[model samples]
Structures are given as structure tokens and as C-alpha cells.
Target: MTDPFAPLPRPRSDLTEPPDAPQALTGGSGVLQGRMLLQVSPARVGLLRPQLDAGRSGLVLCGPNALQQARRLRREEQFSGPLLVDPAVYEVRAASEEEPFPNACEDTFAFDDPLAVSLAEQRAMGVTAPMTPTGYLHAEDSDALKAAVRRVAALDDPQVVFAAPVDVGWLREEDSVRQLIACLRLLAGPKALMLGGQMDPLARHPRAVDHLRRIVAEVPGAALLRTDLAAFGALAAGASFTAFGAGSRLRHIVAPGEKAKTSKNFSTSPHVLFPELMHFFLGKTLADRFAGADGPVCECASCEGARTLDSFASNAGDRQARAASHNVAVLMQWLRTLTAFAPGLARQRWWHERCRTAVDRYPLLNAQLQQPNGFKVPPQLKRWALAAPASEAALPRADAKDYRSP
Candidate 1:
């Protein structure tokens, strides 16, 4: 169902993405959701058929020396059904706990730790997305990411041009944001944008909000890619596609300075989302608060009765994956619905409605949203907020108060 080449599905009248999702979108099992893509290591190609059988797509992203394993999987028929393979440059070296920060001046990909997959090899493989070794860049290297984009294209390979990730943290800075967008504006053809790294802070930042509009305008044809599981809002904002993983960690970017690590345990469950508030509460204690709140607790078949306050107290990872699955499922459904609405009009309506509902759901979160005018609520959104929704009783206005950093 996820043929990357297939044209985007027409928007449906019953769409439930942002501005309008039924409670079920956030409540059910996300496994087998057709639009969802499972990001896996080369060895995990075994998951291809299982995910495909369950109505999902499998994507294999290799790093460093994983080409051989990727080739083997490609050679086998079990993984050939509409698959996408890309090269990912993960960590260069393990981080020293004492020296947590890598030089911001250095390439995000370590210099010595290079891509094992060669140009000849990549061409022979006939992969899906041709990705050059890219990661976070130093402010000096804003040009580096754009340079990498050209390097990947010069090879005359893959059908899609995937840009390396833009560190959201860096994108929040005024100068860095200008440089990155300026570099992207220079690109001649379309490319996929992967926004990564510590997100919550970036999401709340003022500069990042306005810059997002420029990212979309400059690279009008560029695809906005999301792996940062919480960026469904970005889809409404302008991300064209998304990437997901076999485990929860794959769904979000690794720490800026940290090397990639695998967890043997399945992610635990009950990471409940108060959609209205956009607040996430981990563990059973927080989830129990929503018991009987219809669709608040995950009811994915896997966690039918297994998800509970007791299960989380034990701190099992399997429990976390359940909630994560539901979260992705909701996002997938949201993307599906988005296909039906026009980008600007529908998305604006959706964003406003979600904020309205969010305020209605939890006024406390609004306290954070109300943190003053310097934030990016988008001009259209700000206008909408000023009109009908903001004045509604749903959002109780707080008396003028001093701003406190979150």
C-alpha cells in the first residue's frame, strides 16, 4: 500500500488529522498501519514480510559497514515488496561521558568513521532513497549539508534526493536558521528534509517557528521528512513525508553528541497522550489518571488487558512500545487524512482547532503557550486565535504575569 512512487491519495471528506481526528486515531494499535514505515537495521530485514503482511512498509537504513547485510536482504525475495533502502551515517565514535560535547565545528558524522557503501555499490543495489553520509553540522558546516546534497545528486543514483537532518536545536538560533535556510534555498532540485534532535525545546522556541515557514517557502518542492515521532504538527506545517523505526528510539533522533545504542528490551507501554494538551505522561501512574476516559488509554490488541499502572511500575520496555505504536498509528492516520485537505487552508483550520481543543483539555498547558508574543503562532494562526477560539471559555486567560523559562 505504501508504494513510494504512488501518487498521494486524494483527500477524504471524513479526514481526522490535526484540526480534526476522532479519538480512535490516538487510541488503537498502530501495527499494520499501511502508511507507516518500519525503519530497521540491515539484519532486521526479517521484519519486512511480517510488517508487510500486517499492512506496513519496511525501510532499511544502513550505516558504516552494513552494505553486505543489506545486499543479502535485497537479494532475497522476502524483502523485495516495495522496499526503500538508504544509507545513514550514525555516530563516528562512542562519546566520552566526561567530554559530552563533540566539536560543533566538526561534521556530525565522524571524519574517520565513513560510509562503507560505495557509489558503485549503491548504484548496483538500485536503492530507494540515495542518502549521503549526513548528520548534525557545525554552524560553519551549514554549507556542508548543502554540499552533501549536491554530492548525492552528482552520483546520478537514487530516485529521491534526501537531505541530511537539520538539527532543530540549531535551527532555533537566528544566525544558524538563516544560514541553513539560505543554503537550502540555493538547491536546484527537490530534496527530503529530515528534522531531527532534541525536539521539545525547539518546538517551544520563538525563532524556530518563523523559520519553519521559510524552510517550506524556499524549498517549495522539498519533502519535509519526519522521524521525530511528535512532529505531526509539522506535517500540517509542511513536512511532506515521514520515517519510522522498528523500535521507539528509531522514531526520534539520537542525542546530538551521543552514539547510537540498541535496547534489547521492547519499549514499554502507556505513554499516554493528552492530545488536547500535547503533553505526554509516561508510566502507569499518569495513564491511570485517564482510566475510563474513553480512548485515552491504549487499547491496541497487544495491550488489551496488559497495560496498567501495575505493569509500568515494574518498568518493562514492552509496555512502552505499545504506547509508542499507538502514537505512530495515530500519526499515520493523521497523515492519511491530511492527503484530503488542501495544505494551507485545511492545515490552518486543523492547527487552530487542535490548539482550541488543547486549551479546552488542559488550561495549564496554555500557560506555556501564552508565554508571550515573541513565539511563532503563524500569522494566520495568530489571527484565528485572536478571533473565535482564544476568547472562548475553553481557554481561561491568565492575568498578566512575568515570563518564566520552561
Candidate 2:
């Protein structure tokens, strides 16, 4: 019998590539090979050249505002790496100060009327931008998603492809998965799945991760990616590769569109995102501020010489690039570490163990996964998380109002 779960066929052009050391990735001589991509805005694309030169490999992602800039770079023949364009069609596509992006609808039908608004007033705050037509989103029905794919594909680069219906978080129905799978199967090539917006990667809605894993297995050639470091744990679930948003909070999601700074109280930068935690700290300064006499907590290439408190005050572009570079390092190291663990569930277990340790080390980090604003956690994932070793023991007791991760 044909196995539905069997691996899918590879792309004709062979879009995906072998990692720097395939043998290191897979114990087997001819084993696994893949690329770790970077999801950056047009402003950050320049960072790619250095990363590429540094022996780091990954794709680049951009929003609409930077699309032309990215294209110019491509046409200039400056960057030879894969480039991805995001089409945030989950909601109304509109122009914002940041760029032209698909933003959450101003008024979700759920609260179209004041009556319904009051009925669920408590949840009103939880509903973020891009509430999506049916309380979630899908590119299958979006012409924008289709058009984006065509536009990117038309770029005539095998390395390019568009990511749509980025998240299946609100896709609660089995048919939803099946339908989306049908659309996914029809994608041209160099397929990539994005876990965008509202997803707490560490504490993914249980079903969303399952759906994601299913996609990875079914389309073995597709890249399972997340711009947000929060969802980096998806790597454990059999994701081929993950791009760090420079670990800056700016590397975020929306249906494909997806925020921010200070002094000592500004230890975290609004734009500078930290992994394992939902909060953003003051930029390089915060990172430098936290630096002990020995040195900054992060000695990543980007963080070097950034130990000065004023260094954190570096302009957004410089600081963003530095933060992004550091995140690339973090993801690559994990990729290598997981390589030792064969493939499949074994890799996931390795990832989970590390995540478990991190959560245990800093319980506050779990705040990102808590799905604040009355948002319910995916039941399946909540159960799965609870089953982890010391899961409940490590969590703040229900009565504990304060959680300080010292």
C-alpha cells in the first residue's frame, strides 16, 4: 500500500542544499543536508553579504516596503542566496508606516456589532490585528497569497517562493488541514512553511505543531521555518531549517505580517528580541548592560565590542543587524547539536530537553508561551508540555503572582 506518510518527491531544480558538513549532520555518510535561512527586512538584507562570506548559509525574507530594494539587490547580482517574499493576505492588505503589509482587520466580524463586542468583552483585548475572516487565516482562499506566489515565482529564481497561510493556529478542523495540504501540494517549488504571528513556538498550540510536523513529513522537500525565535523549538519537531529574526523582536509574523526601548528599566530593547522569552530588552546597551565584568552575556560576533552601555544605543539598523547575526549563530549551533541525534522524533526529543532546561532555568521565559489576553493554549500542546519532565514542577504555582527568573 502506498504510504500517505511517506516522504514526498524532491524539487526538480533541487532548491535545498547540503549543510556545510553533511556527515556531521547525519551519522550516515550520505545523510542529511539543508540550509539555515535568515528572515530579514529589506533594511537588513545588506547583512546577508557578510553572513554569506562568513560561511553562514540561509534565505532572506522581506516585506512589501523592502521588496523593491531586495529585488534591486538581487538584480544587481549582489546576493546569490535564496530570497523569499512574504504575502500577508490573511487580513486587509494595507499600507502602514512600516511598509505595505496585510494587517489585522480593524473590526473582526466576531465583534462587528456592539452587542457581540460586549458579549465577549473580556476577549476583545486578546484579539490582535489580523483577527482573520473566520477567526483565523488561510492562503488557500486568498487571491493575494496566490498572486504573491506567482509574483515571487515569476522572479524566475528557483530559490524564490512565497509563504502563505503562514499559521494553522486557528485551523481547528481536520478538513482545514486537509484543504491547506491540498494547496500546499500545489505550490510551485522551493516550498517553505511559516509559523507566523501569535504563535508561541515553545508553547505552540498543540495541534498547530502536529499539523506542522505532518507537513514536514508529507513534503519532505519543504522548509519549515519561523522568523520569530519564539517558535525556534519547531526545529525539534522535524523542521528542516529555521531562520532567526536576528532574535530581534522585529523579526515577527502577521498572517504573514507581524513590534518594539529604554534605560536600566530598558534592559531590553523594544526591537531587540531575546530568545526563550517573549519580552524585548533594551538593544545592544541592555545586552551590554547585563554584561558582567568578565564580558557581555552574549559574546557572539554581533555582540562583540557592544558591551558598552552606549553600544546598546547603537542605531536601530546596526543593533538590529548585530542582534540578527547573534540569533543566526544560536540557530546554527542548535542545528549542529541536533545533527548528532539522527532525524525525526529523536531530534525533537533533543530539542525538547534543551527547551525544558531553559524553561526550568527561567520560568519567566514561559510567559511568552502563556498566550496572554485570555487566549487559550492549544489543548493538545498543553497536554504534551505537561508530560515533559519537571514540566509542572518547574512552572510557577497557580497562586504565585510573581515569577522572577534569577
Per-candidate TM-scores read 0.58, 0.54
lDDT of all predictions, in order shown? 0.43, 0.41
Question: Highest TM-score, which number?
Answer: 1
Runs in model 1 deviating more than 4 A are 1-82, 93-126, 156-160, 173-175, 188-190, 199-201, 244-248, 251-280, 288-321, 364-406
lDDT tens per residue, model 1, 178-290: 66665544433334555555424245455554565456545534444435432344444554333555444454455456545543222333444333344444555343443
lDDT of 2 by residue, 239-292 (tens): 444555543333444542342221244434434434333234456534443344
* TM-score for candidate 2, residues paired by index: 0.54
Tell me how many clashing residue pairs each candidate has: 12, 21
Q: Which ten residues in a row have the lowest lDDT in candidate 1?
A: 20-29
